[model samples]
Target: MTLSRRHLIAAAPLLGLTAPAVAQDAPLRFAVGPFQPTAGDTRRAYEPFFVHLAASLGRPYRLTVTADWAGIAVALATEQLDGAWMGPWGLGTR
Candidate 1:
């Protein structure tokens, strides 16, 4: 879904850390921050969690590793990310 900038901003809060409303078959866009030194490392570390979400949600997903801690929030705000694994600080982005 192509979200307008206005809609993206408006829905940021409502979306939380989960995906925007989408078809079950639509690939959910999951994001990871710079918790690890490298994007590959981060993706590897979070692989199992993504597997779990895939199994539980019964849907496909794509992962994005942000270059910095704040990139996750930026991705969310721009509607580039659908789901994310974040801590307290990410919550403040709203």
Candidate 2:
């Protein structure tokens, strides 16, 4: 069963079409800065917000908040997270 050149060419676009759908399945990483009084405080304030966002997006969202502002920057730079909610200073640096 050899694959003809025409068959290969026909399949190429199908493969490309599947990529976007696969990418859409990926989970979103939400980096929540230490923008609150504490980890507990931040979680309490934003946990519901994130749940709603994730539901609306039809994707999972993992909340990550560093102990300090520097940690949040490192996570963002490394691409460990996709986006973040930051305070005034956090937004300024990014």
Candidate 3:
């Protein structure tokens, strides 16, 4: 079945390490920092990667482009992001 953007958005809050009760079919929400020239550019660059990841895992994957490193961190910390591509500096101390 084709997953819609609404479905992915609905699943965002329950994605990633903190989501133990998430369904197996739930889409993985992958977050990326704003390191590229634009959000569209970042999405274009990583779309193939996410597609391959979904195919390999037999599950759907969604890409979320954050406005900045802080946004990425917030998404991760709040369990809204299942995975992330970010720099070490963005990973603040615990």
> By lDDT, who's the top model here?
1
| Full ranking by lDDT | 1, 3, 2
Which candidate do you rate higher for lDDT, 1 or 3?
Answer: 1
* Cα TM-score per model: 0.66, 0.63, 0.66
Model 2 lDDT-worst window of ten? 13-22
TM-score of 3: 0.66
What value does the lDDT take at residue 17 in candidate 1? 35
**Per-model CA lDDT versus the true structure:** 0.65, 0.60, 0.65
| Cα lDDT of model 2 by residue, 12-76, tens digit | 33322133432476776776767578898988887786576556545676887677767767876
Q: Highest TM-score, which number?
A: 3
Per-residue lDDT tens digits for candidate 1, residues 1-94, read 5445456445545545334344357776878777787888988998787676554555677887778767877887887777677855543222
Question: What is the C-alpha RMSD, rounded to one decimal, of candidate 2?
Answer: 13.1
